[model samples]
Target: MGACPCGTGRDYDDCCGPLHAGVPAADAQALMRSRYSAYVREDADYLLRSWHRSTRPHALAFDEPRPAWLRLEVLRHVATGPDSAEVEFVARYRIGGGSVVRMRERSRFLREDGNWFYLDAVGG
Candidate 1:
């Protein structure tokens, strides 16, 4: 369960610690990846923590049916500035019946107080 591409060597905590602690990522791309990891792991805390307050929901529940996350692929990343960035990626997964599901999204981020927060989602 410790393998995560977000570069958090000791699972989500040791790797995306700052990101989950409300510390903005140094760039947009980093934030996007960390959020993806959060979803795959069902780490609602991390998701809520990284969401921009203006758009963040009151609560995030991940206790529903679970999906078997297969792989994460970061297709492209573009940074306009320290405070703004976009990432396009695909997250693949599988559930019952050997079915495979893929989620693709172009994510946006904003930097605040030296941390990156997920601002919004574009396409999926």
Candidate 2:
């Protein structure tokens, strides 16, 4: 938790730490970054915790060959309210063969229990 999971030039304390530490983020972009961190660390519980139940699967499996996260680029973010938002982003990674892949998607989010949760992927 000491390192910034978002790989941003700031410390965790200045980045996604506040959201993970129970402090609510003011908008969708902040929540999106924290969710990225959750993916990097393979924190399934955290991912589940921050996922909207309606769209969330009963269980999530992260069985892909471990890959290093090269970068996370947030392309755009739009918020409708404290409880609804959308973010478009690309997450790049390098696999064992040194093959790089960029996952680009528009993600939806909703706030529940005063915490923002990932809702679903709305194809871009």
Candidate 3:
């Protein structure tokens, strides 16, 4: 099996695969990593399902010429509250024949019941 797209250096099945297969993530960080893996796999359904209803869009659509996601570097993961957390990461990608672009964001997540959901970007 190939390495997981989340840069975990582990087989997909051992890493993000189970999360994609309907298993609940153990923590907010796992959910964040799985969300990145979902983007790499182009799994819009999983993304939407994992998103907080308050900020989730009606749908998710990849750009016409999808960007080639290269790598992910998680810079920080902090538990802001008993049921809230934030993860800051840098993701590099390249659009059709374009130079790689590095995008960074600090995303917030909240746990409702026992499932973690992505809330929104913390800051620009």
Best by lDDT: 3
Residue pairs with colliding backbones in model 3 are none
Q: After TM-score superposition, what is the CA distance of residue 120 in candidate 2 from its true location, in Å?
A: 0.4
Candidates 1 and 3, the one with greater lDDT: 3
State the lDDT of candidate 3 residue by residue for 5-122, as single tens digits.
Answer: 9998999999999999999999988999999999999999999999999999999998788989999999999999999999999999999899999999999999998999999997
Best by TM-score: 3
Give candidate 1's error at residue 6 in angstroms. 4.6
lDDT of 1 by residue, 40-114 (tens): 768898888889998999999865467777777788888868568888888887775577888899888887877
Model 3 segments more than 4 A misplaced: none
**What lDDT would candidate 2 get against the real structure?**
0.81
- Superior by lDDT: candidate 2 or candidate 3: 3
Candidate 1 pairs with clashing backbones: 8-15, 24-115, 24-116, 25-115, 25-116
lDDT of 3 at 31: 96
Write down the RMSD of all candidates, one decimal each.
2.7, 2.1, 0.9
Candidate rank order under lDDT: 3, 2, 1
